[model samples]
Structure formats: structure tokens, C-alpha cells
Target: MAKCTAVIDIGSNSMRMAVFQKTSRFSFHILHEVKSSVRLSEHAYKNDGYLQSATMNRTAQAIGEFLSIARSFGARKLLCVATSALRDAPNAQEFISRIQREHNLSIKVIDGEKEAYLGAIACANLLPKMDALTVDVGGGSSEFAVLRNGKVETLYSLNIGTVRIKELFFDRNDLAGAVAYIDNALSALPDFGIDTFIGIGGTFRALTRALMKKENYPLKKLHAYTTDDVRFQTFAEQILQAGPKKLKSLYIKTDRFDTIKPGTLILQRILKYTCAQKLVCSGVGVREGVFLNDLLRNSAASFPANYNPSVRYLLDTYATHSDHGIQCSHLVKRLFDLLQAPLNLKADYRHDLVIAAKLLPIGIGIRYYAYQRHSHNIAMSGLDYALSHTQIVLISHLLLFKKGSRSSSLIPRAGYGTLLPDNATVDALSAILWLSHILLAARINADTLSVHYIDGKLEIRGKHLYLAKEQLRNIVLPKNLIVVFQE
Candidate 1:
């Protein structure tokens, strides 16, 4: 039986409910998600730091609606976690009681330490393998986690947040003071080793989307999107100088004007503090964290280190089984190993080529004609949890090449080709996949199929096979590689 769970995370700035369907023992995919900008922290920190009765009532209603929608998905398990705003309110118990008494729901208000750890769990598992200083910046507080070697070495939940900063520091023209506040508040944080800043929460996502628009980024996917400090600073300056009207002109949602600039300003401080050059925006945060925690409850693993790819899990859940993918994967690797000598391709491509081969048949399972093209789209935008943005593009291109990807339109130009390595990189890898594909489709069984540098001419010594017009296209390799097949 398929087990599904919903995690409803009530944060200071927004309320989110994510439904995660367990696709495998260790991995799950988002079945459904709904978020509301309830801004539970609105005025909750004023004076005595009590959740205004009206604010609590409104957020409670949002929670009830989210729970109802979650129930519709047949979610057998529901976990609700509230952070920051609720934790700070002196009358938090009163609000919690109201949730239980009115909606018969139990809300676990976790502490700052747990909140930071959960954010780490979501990031370490979903993003690529990289050491980063991760920050889950919320409306009420920001959680900093130092991720090194797939583990969070240090974490802190500071009271510095977008909403808090806006309230206390936005009106002050002294930008230096705001940064000084951040530095002072986070004085206890240890010296950071990694330079990559993994920015989470809605504000960072909003900033990322806005930057994507400014730069006309092509991928259109938000997770794992990276931007350099210079580009982001340009937007940050505009956001800082612009009012709500100007932000709208820049394509930033007007609703975010009240907080986006402040958030970006805080981000600037974080960058300076860590001297990080890159900001990897993660769409996953505390809500996804809660769902992952529950999903891995009984498992021995506590992190993303050994988790199965969410792509593999989703394919399994959809019952898209393909033994051909497995076969192609093996055949492609063998060809790469045998051909790399004369091809002069790097060993780094082997893993990517294998992934490309394994995921090829998934598109055919969807439709037969131009299935490779469909596979290309899925690989670029659909698969999740493991491969980096670079890997995704390479795999997508390999899939395209596997099906004779040669035309100008067929080139999978992600990051406008700049993000992709030089043509020689994919060219050689694609050549290998293309040849392996032909042999697999033709069922050409050869006792000896190998590449040999014979008399300075690449020779194919395989079973004297007839090459068709299009078959020759498969043999076209990178300008640098010279190879002859022999069987």
C-alpha cells in the first residue's frame, strides 16, 4: 500500500502545507502543496509578544483549510509544526489550545535548534553535493546551518529576520547599522569554512525568481538555481532604492515590497559575513524538512547522504518500469570505457552517461514517437533530489544525443550554453551514447567490440556491420576525438 503524509508548517511569514507520497522506503515526492501568506508574525511581536487574537484566528482558519485539502489526498498521517512567531509569543499555549479545541489539531512548536536542523535535512538531501553555509531566513528569524561533507557541522537560529529587521532597521537610513545588528546578534557563530551560501525561505525564493527574470534565465526551475553576488547585488540595490511601485516595475510582486528589500539587504550582510561568492536558492525549507523527517522516521539514515533519488522514486510510484533503461545504461558505460582511450574523453562523464542511459526509456513509456525529445524535457525539468543543475543538463543532452541529437534545435542549451562545458565535452559523451544506442537497437551482438588507434585512423573492428545514412551520424564524434570501432 502506498503511504502518504502531509506536513503543515506554520511559519512567521507564511503558512505552508506539503503532501509527500512515499514512493520508496527512503525517498518521496511532493504529491501536492498549498501555501498561504498568512504572515502569522504580523504584529505578534509587538509589546508583550503575544499573538493577537485576530491573527491567531485567521491563521487557525488557514490551517483548517490546509488540513481539509490534505485529507482529500487520502493522507493517513498529518504533522503540523509551527516556528518562530509562535515560539516567541507569551500566549502561544493559548493559541495552541485554540487549535486543539476548535479544530481538534495538535501543533508542535519546535525550538530554534530543531528548526535549523530540519532545514539542514531538507537542503543536504535535495541539493547537489557541496559544502555550503545554509540559511533558512524566515519572517521572524533566520536559521544558519553550515553543511560540510553532507553533514551540518554547525547551526544557529538567530532572531534576525526579514520582518524583524524591517520593523527595527528599515526606517533607519544607516545600512551599516543593520549589518552591525546582524553581526552582533550572530557573534557567537563559529568561523565558516565554505564559501557557498545556500539561501532558503520565501524571501530568497522571491529574490531568485526576480533575478531570473532580470537575467532572463531559461531553465524556469527555481530549486538549485545559482546567481553570483554581483548580479544579485544589482537587484538588491534596485530593491533597496525602489518603493512598491518601482518593485512592481522590476517584476517583483508588490506584496513583497514590504519585506523583499529588507530580506535581500539581510542576505547582503550574510554574504559579507561569510565572504561567500555564490547563493544557491533552495525552494525546500522547514515544511519539506518536516515531511522528510517523518518519511525517514524508521529508517537508519538521518540525512540525504544515502537517500535514493526522488526521480527514481517517482518513476517507481507511477509504475513506469523499463528494463531497457538498465540495459542501455550498462551498454553505454561499457562503450565509454572501451572508447575513452582514443576519444580522449574525461572519466568524469561516465557517471552522467550512465544516468542518461538509465533514464532514456522513461520517455518511451509516456509515448513512442519522438520519445527521446519528451525524455529530454522530463530530464531537464522533472527529475529531482539527486543530480545537480549541471548534471541535469548533461543528462538531458545525452538523452537527446542518444536519439541523434545534432540539429541546432536539438542542442539542449541550458544556461545559454555558458553553463554547459565546451562543445567537445558533450560531443564526445554523446557520440558514445549514440553508438551504444544503435548497437542496442540493432541487437548487434559482437564477441569483440572495441576502439583502437590503428595507423592513426580510428577503426571499428566490430562485426563488419552495414552503416546506414543516419547510422553515420551516430559515429560523428567531437572534433578532438578519433576512434574506430572493432568487433
Candidate 2:
């Protein structure tokens, strides 16, 4: 595989390109992303599913520019796929041939089933595992993939879409006709008794973003944001009934006004059909799936056991003193084992704690001074894949608090209290980390330090005790916990 690979998705409504750079065999990060509103199916749906000349020209130009950007980033492999627009069009070969001749780019026109599979695999590998139906509502068609226990079970695509419905029924101002058309298409799908829905593509993302803002969500990350079905259904109903002025007030962008209603209706009806109880918004789609499919072709399209792409990427690119980081991680784990019972920390938290400790010194690669802030910001933004928003926020906060800090004050004061465990839990975790930092501050070998907890007091015995003992005074211990250092 190329060190840097580019994946392009030419949809009915948008043309997007993402460039991913590999850090290790199975670790990678997105380097650049570009999106253009080409709207390739603009007049095609109304004109008997024939590719229009004007939209084709615009799409060609965008693809050409995307290729230039990809080449600028030294991308050696390019995988470009076209979805409903090209597959439904009668004259798609004309646009494909033109792109091939002019820009030397080959566009693979994928069927609806393959398209749904791509989107499903992306969510399966990138987001937290779940058993649900993945809904991808595009401009020309809507695709569904059934995922069970981190595996894709089935896939289906419907002829109903935002642009298709808009041209066929909504343009005629026939609301009942639109609903009937959607229901007719949906009737072919069998119920799977799945109560959760994973929404993909731009329409779902836009709606979820608006919901996030209206509810004053603290976390800015959108990938794993979750909401109950009742709230989402109400919001979708309001969108269907909202006028142009009302949509603007609801935070719907002006660019999406024309097709938002159709997309919302498609999504709302599907949610009803599936009897969805929860909605998990997906920020990844076919493009990411394409990359992952190629990146993990040998590994059965799944990451190695116990491996996280985002964490590996962080360690690969940012970790300066990896030996120390590894040592620190071991020390923290040992400390966690000794204090887990007394501190009452959950066993599941150990994974996150180890990762945070291993990457704590990554900020030093950027600069030596005030590196903790850098580490905090990097963790908040870069730990995006395969983890929930709460875990991400908690790990970032754990990296932020060092010696002489109280987790209760720092977390709530920094607006992340809602995303963390209770104050006592956080303080215990923070205290363990702080104590580890103090023990290793003198760059002593981790083997030189030993820790044990008995009753309510914690004892540490190590060589070069002066620095550890001195820094211990400036730090705050967990409530009712005592630390005694010995040489």
C-alpha cells in the first residue's frame, strides 16, 4: 500500500476527496480533505436519469482539482468511486470516459449494494461496535446495511432519495405522494428487530450538528454524538413541516434548504420503519471504508486485536521519547493494580489510563515548555476513531491535570464535567497519574520504584528519593489517602 492514499467519492450532491497517510502497518491518519457541491444529479432525475452536460462538466472540473490536491500531498494510490448518481444515470459512461481521457482518473461506478457495504464497513471499523442498521441517504438513492456484533450482515438500497423524491414528487408539491413513494420502496425490506440506527452521509450529519447546537452539547465532536429516537423523531417532524424562514432559525444552512426536507423525510420514515430507539451519528462514510478496505485487506478488513488506529497514529507521529513513555505506561499500570481496590476505579478504565500515560509526553515533541497543554489539545482533537466522546474527553482531561491539581475543580471549570465519571473517580485516577509522574520525574528506571497500598495509606520505596519526596509536597493526594516514600 502507498504511504499516502487518496479516496474520492463522487455522489449525486457532492464531490469529496480524503487523503490518508499511513504511520505503521495498520495505523493511519487523514492528512487532507476537500469537498465541493458539484450536485452531479441536479437535472438528471428530472430528465429521465440522464447525465446532464452542465453538471458533468462541473464534476469533471472538481475531480481534476481533487487529483491535483492529492498529488500535492504525494498520494501514490487513488481510489475513486461514484454512487447513486452515476449508477442510476443512463449516460454515466460519457462522464467516466471524459474524466478518464482528460484527467487520467478512472471512476468506478459501484452498485447500491457495494456502496452500502462500503459505508457499513467504515462505521464498523471506526465507531464503537453496535448491532444496528446503517442508513445512508444520498441525493439519488438511499442505502441500508445491517450490522450485527461488529459484522455487516446484509445490505439493501432503495430508489428513494432526496433529489429523486424532490424531482418525482416534492417538485409537484405532493406530500402524500412522496410519503407513499418512500413507503412503497421501504416495504420491500424485512424487519430485523434492530432498535439502533447509525446515520451516515451529509444529510444525517447536518441534522445531527443542528441538534447538537440547539441542545447546547458541551463536546464539539460529532462522530459519536448520540440522541434518543423520540427527540430525533420530533426534530425530523419539525424539519419536514418547517418553512424556509423556520429552517434558517433552526440552524439549517441555506445551502441545504432545497433538499433538507426530502432527506429528513427519507431518514424519518426509515427510522419509523426500523422502530429505531437510538441514533448514532457517523462522520465517516464510503471514502473511509474504501481506505480501510485497502489498508486492511490482509487482516480480514478488521484491525488487529486490541489495536486502535487513532492511538497508534498518535504514538507513531507525536511520541518523542517512546522508551520513557513505555516505561511510564508500565509504571502507571502497576500503580493502578495496587490501588484499584482502594481507589475504586473501574477495571475498564485501565485501558484508557494506560493509553493516556503512554502518550502523556507526546506534547514534548512540539515543544519542551508547557507541553501538558499541547498534549491535552492533541488528545482532544486527534483521539477521534473507535472511541466514544466521553472516553475521549476523559483521556484528554487526564492528560491535562498534573501535580498540585484537583480533578473536581479542573474538569468542571473547563466545561468537561458532564463527560466524565464522578468527581471522586476522576480524582483517584488523577492522583495515581500524578504520583507516577513524581516517582519518575528524575528519569529513574521504572524498575527502581516499588509501590504498595495497605489499609488507607500508600507507600513508595525507590532510589534517588530526594526529587520524588520534594515534589510530593506540591501535589494533592486523593481524599483520605496517604503516601509515604522510602529510600
Error of 2 at 171 (Å): 0.8
Over 14-118, each residue of candidate 1 has an lDDT whose tens digit, in order, gives 889988877666656788989888877777655456677777878988988998998899988888999998899888899899999988889999999899988
* Error of model 1, residue 318, in angstroms: 6.4
Highest-lDDT candidate:
2
Go through the candidates in order and give the clash count of each.
12, 0
For each candidate, the alpha-carbon lDDT, in order, equals 0.75, 0.88
lDDT of 1 at 280: 91
Which parts of model 2 are misplaced by more than 4 Å? 412-414, 444-448, 461-466
Question: Candidate 2, residues 214-265: lDDT per residue as tens digits?
Answer: 8888999889898999999999998999999999888899999989999999
